[model samples]
Target: MRNFKAFGHVIIALFIISLSAWCHGQVELDKAPMEKAEKDALFSTIQGFVGNWWNGSDLYPDPCGWTPIEGVSCDLFDGFWYVTVLNIGPIYENSLSCAKNLEFRPHLFELKHLKTLSLFKCFRSQRRHQVTIPNANWENLAGSLRSLEFRSNTGLIGKIPSSFGVLKKLQSLVLLENGLTGEIPPEIGNLKKLNRLVIAENYLSGHIPDIFTALGDLLILDLSRNSLSGSLPLTLGCLTSLLKLDVSNNHLEGNLLKEFAYLKNLTLLDLGNNRFSGGLTLSIQEMHSLEEMVLSNNAIGGDIRILKWENLHNLVSLDLSNMGLNGEIPESIIQLKRLRFLRLSDNNLTGNLSPKLSTLPSLNALYVSGNNLAGELKFSMEFYGKMGTRFGAWNNPNLCCPLGAIATSNVPFGVKPCQQQIKLVESNTNGSDVNKTFYSIASLCHAPNHFWWTFPFIMILFLNSYIIGL
Candidate 1:
């Protein structure tokens, strides 16, 4: 019942977000006249990409006043309307789908007041036709553009423009899941005010430029799922204000650096599925603010007890699975009261399944499978009831689950239940039955014929004894 309520709340939140976006992109009005030159530039740019069939001016008495382009948003400045945000591609139901012969026009960069421009799935057909983004002249909008994004355009092949570095005012730049090849241009570091730079799921290869630390205000820097190789720049520790840093699923190789402790505000750090080797540094554990830390699938063999995990009081999700981590599971790990997910599977971890694990109130998913863990699990029935199959404890031959009084509704998978032991009673080895021997001796005294003879013998013996005495 609690889970259902939580799920329903999530659904409501998502609906609210969708409605907000729809409201922001739909019907917006400012009864001011738009500049003729900027309007022409906007019309030509829209016609070139969305294919001319949808007449812009004919849609309403004033497009900016009544019904505007589905994705384009405008703002009033000096009593004149100007395009501030334009989002192309099939994002909304009425959003203009890319024309079969879509093309970029020079007028796109002429919107002097434009602050945002995003293209989503405009070049989706990878095999049919491909297009490269403009390699130059991005400087025209450098003064006003604050955000730029290109998302999920598979046929968009080419190198990221080096000219983009001139956009000093740009606060966010996202290039997600495209076929853009080549290395990330170093000029991207020149954006001093950059807050977020997400360029993942591409064919990009090369070492991440050391210029990353230049963006002092960088909040999120994700470069996951690419072909990037070579050692990560040590200077990355200089981004002290960085919050989320994900370089997973790349070929980066290096030792975990102690300089990582400089990131006093980092919340999420994922370096999984890389070629990182050597010891897992304790410096990262010093980042007490880290909520999620994923370092799985690297050859970074290390003892799990190197750092006191209790220091990371804000830890929520911790994954150290599939690495060759050794030593016993540290008891101090149970100190993280807010820990919800803990995965230590496929490692060389040893020792007993501590009963204190059940004491963590927020822990829901705990996977410690494929380790050298031993002894009977001592968690309460309520713990097993809530966790169920989420408590993964498989492939440890020496480990067993408690039974008898405990129930199995939420038994941890892939481990055997403990067997009940019984003591055997000893049998008499002298080969005589006690009951039969006692009954045989008693019958001699009780039988009728035997009693008569016994009385005569007794009387004769008494007379003989009396005569001798007299």
Candidate 2:
């Protein structure tokens, strides 16, 4: 009986030990391989922000596991789950907290596996507290980072770090609509692998660096609305792969470079509101892929006919408003079948408005106001009504003609009533008397409705007398 009891106790002990070992193994499998030190650093940095949802608790004990944090993604690296992308913003509800004085924590650089880091309107503050981007340790992650973006942070002030050139793997870098000042670092040319670099709507000044021609793979380069000045470098033409290039609303001066024709892939080129002078060059006609060309509010001069506009078949929008352009508008412009917006306002252009201009199937907005244009508006009533205020042909003194079918109020402003001309014969009359009689005939024709029938009756009477005399 003693031996039986002892054997039963031994069996129970062995079973309990086996069960304990199996449970331990399962627990190990459930836990993440991420180092506890790195996890604590990430959570601590997030805690400093007042509006963040990350609170150190068992509720999210494994950040890389089932309870993953918002705007944070992880991937397995060397048998450990590491944060690979950190998109800190209000991307998801109850995700990130917004706080003033939100300085980037050094602990963020500890995520050695981070490939992309974006902060959208995250550093904004009601108090206008300025935050400078940290330039000290960016080189630490140069090897891992592939993209970095900081958009619409009004309080972000400071020059872009030249150290960013060391990030060889970076493909896209966008720092749009910030308060950043100073010249774009020439070192940015070193980013050979970069595809898109947009730093528009900032206080950046100085001439565009000639070194930019080195970025052969760049597709979109927008440095608009800055204080940049100087002539564009001829080297810009080397960027054959460029699709969109906007350098508008700056102080840039000089003649448009002919080398721009080399950008075969360019779709949009905006150099408006600058000091560019000289005539529209043939270089622009060579851009077969161009869709929108904006040279408005510049000093560009020359007749519209100087351009071989027929070559630009893909053009959709052409804005040459307020340029010192003169001479008659080229009738060939009607060849642009895809044209939708044509703005030639505030120019010195002359000649009668083309009837075909109003008939273009795709044209919706036509602004030729403030020009020296004359003659009658022969557009269809339906087309004129459809254009409405978009047809701005005001401020032209000699432009005449009443709207047909469409109300006069619907017609473009400053249009005068069409004049009537009547030829009079004064046999044996001197020059002065003939002039007086001509003026009298003109005044008679100016009279209300009676003038139309009265003039015809007078003409028939003169014809009958001449026939009888003959």
Candidate 3:
């Protein structure tokens, strides 16, 4: 009876030990597959980047643990290697693609860990008597890409594909200096993580997208140098994070939107070379951080009252050129203590040249040319004596004396004598100076000749009288 009980106990103990061992083995087995899966996924992503269609050259068949291409970086998380960045710009631009039909690699979409991808200066190889197309597959880009830049691709064309919205993780998208055309896709607003959106220097047309207001996190929005028409969208003020906004060089027109006052964080704003009209009278009090402001080449017309510069204490560069501004350049401009560059050219401004501009210690470059500005242009001690070659104001038709006459103005400053003749052409062509000079010379010559002829006759008459007296 004792032996049988002992045997049963031994059998039970062996069975329990076997079960524990099996459970441990199973856990070990499960971890190996999980780790393998992660490694495979990462390797696959790296292979995709290497085999990208844009990289027509077989330069990098395997970038992982090899002589990785320049601008390309990899990161190893866990036991897997993944491409964190693929700056294929240098490779694509350096290698010439002679392929008749260039194609963008769809394999790049497999890079699940891609964080940044920039394609700059990717030019196609020159072909003689053959028409070659560009290799840009915007749709095949990895959705995991956080930052994508395709700037200065001189040969790039075609409309922006709507599939761009699939990049949910995208934070920045720059497509500047391309030949892209067609209307902007409203689906661009789908990038909730987007902070900077640049599509400048393209042939894009149509109205400004109202959906852009959904990009609440946007900081820099540049759609300049496009054919976009219509008024500025008032909804653009919703981007509170906006630091720089450039919609210049477009066909956009209208007055400065009242909603622009809400852009308190804006530092650089450019509305130049547009058809924007109407008076600019929004309270700029909240724009304390504003540094550079350009409203040049617009049709904005008014009496040209300048607000207090004390509020714009941080202003560095201010350009109000070609706005049909008439009236004196306000004395308040000198109060902008931090002003470095000021341009008020091509306006109908009439004012006495300000000596106060020379007193500003921070004044570097000032351009008030092509205006009806009159009065003596005085060269400040700081301008001629200290900061030489930094002052420039030309083509002010009414500004006479020193500036108009280059010979007298530059000579006093110890400027080198010009080897060429200095001719001052008066702006008023109807002046009678030429006629006055002709009449004066003719009158002076007539009097001298008449006196000489009459003097001979008088001498002869006196001789005859003396003979009669004799």
Candidate 4:
């Protein structure tokens, strides 16, 4: 009876082990195969490429099975594998060239499950092909496509299609460094879900559309290095969620509107190299979240003292170079504890060097050249010497170095050493009056005469006094 009971226990353990192995094998076989329609679409798109590996053989018989295609990702949907992302370019480590004579294949749009598509340096091979992006067909993927990017396609030209507004599901759209021309379509505002829109380094013209105000969810809006003109629309302030706004290197003109201050979430604001002409707006002080504010190479002129620098505690870089700003460098600027770059060069500002500037722990670059600043620089010699050429205080004729101060070779190029002036006294007496005259001249040397006219008048007064004494 005991032997029969032990034999039954051993058989039960064997059965449990076999059941576990069989269940594991079943799970492996259950992985879905790539859908036939999607696989055919991918095959047709890369068929013209010379050395493509998507040849649909037993080795890569299944793109989502044991074998995987580079830069293509798939996911299981309705018990079948579907291509969800396509990154076609030389993005792989060993990949070198893109398709040489390739054209935009209509089969690419057949991937109904595609959610993301990125093509980098793939369309512009030798500048021979004049590829134009298809506009109306893009709406076909609007149900699933969330991100689309086309970068560095030199041959791409023509106006952006107004049909792009139909892609309501798109969350990001980037088309940078292309040969695209014409105006930005106002229909772009229809994409309410868009979080980022970058179309920089193109030849796009025309004024920015007021329809952009509808994109209240936009976080980054970059349209720099284009031919865009006209004043900024007041409707832009409606995008209160904006973090970075760059419209630099354009032909935009007119005064900066106070409505910009309403963007409380702004971190960076760059409007450099534009044709804007006006006083620096005081409304800018309301941007407490600002980190970098660049307005260089414009005609913005105003007193520096009007800026509320103390409120901008998180400010890191403030560039206003060649903006024609005037007035003294306010001491309140020292309150910006996080300031790293301070460029105010090529302006008409006049003030004594603020000694507090050197004490800021984060200061790295200081440019104040081509100004009317006067008086001795009171910062430590060691600090000034360490800055090298980054410290620009040249071109101020009235500004002079302290007496007997030794400057390094790296000191500002146009700065000159302070010269000590001596008053000459004339007396009628012969040898006896010589000692008294020398004493009178020596006293005038210690007198303060920073102004050019005061030194000559003091010399004449000393001469008259010495003659009377003799």
Per-residue CA lDDT of model 3 for 130-249, tens digit only, reads: 221233444444456889887776566767877677777789999888767888888898888899999999899999888766789999999999999999887887888899999999
Give the Cα error of residue 41 in candidate 3, in Å.
Answer: 11
Clashing pairs counted in every model:
0, 2, 0, 0
Residue pairs with backbone overlap in model 4 = none
lDDT of 2 by residue, 215-319 (tens): 899999999999999999788898999999999999998999999889999999999999999888889989989999999999988887888888888889999
lDDT of candidates 1 onward, in order:
0.85, 0.81, 0.68, 0.80
TM-score of each model, in listed order? 0.83, 0.81, 0.69, 0.84
Top TM-score: which candidate number? Answer: 4
Candidate 1 residue pairs that clash:
none
Ranking 1 against 2 by lDDT, winner: 1
Off by over 4 Å in 1: 1-31, 403-407, 419-421, 431-470
Pick the lDDT winner.
Answer: 1
What is the model-wide C-alpha lDDT for candidate 3? 0.68
Find the 10 residues in a row with the least total lDDT in model 3.
Answer: 437-446
Candidate 4 achieves a global lDDT of 0.80
RMSD of each: 17.4, 9.4, 15.4, 6.9
Model 4 RMSD, rounded to 1 decimal: 6.9
The residue-level lDDT of candidate 1 at 387 comes to 89
Candidate 1: Cα lDDT at 260: 91
Worst 10 residues of 4 by lDDT: 437-446
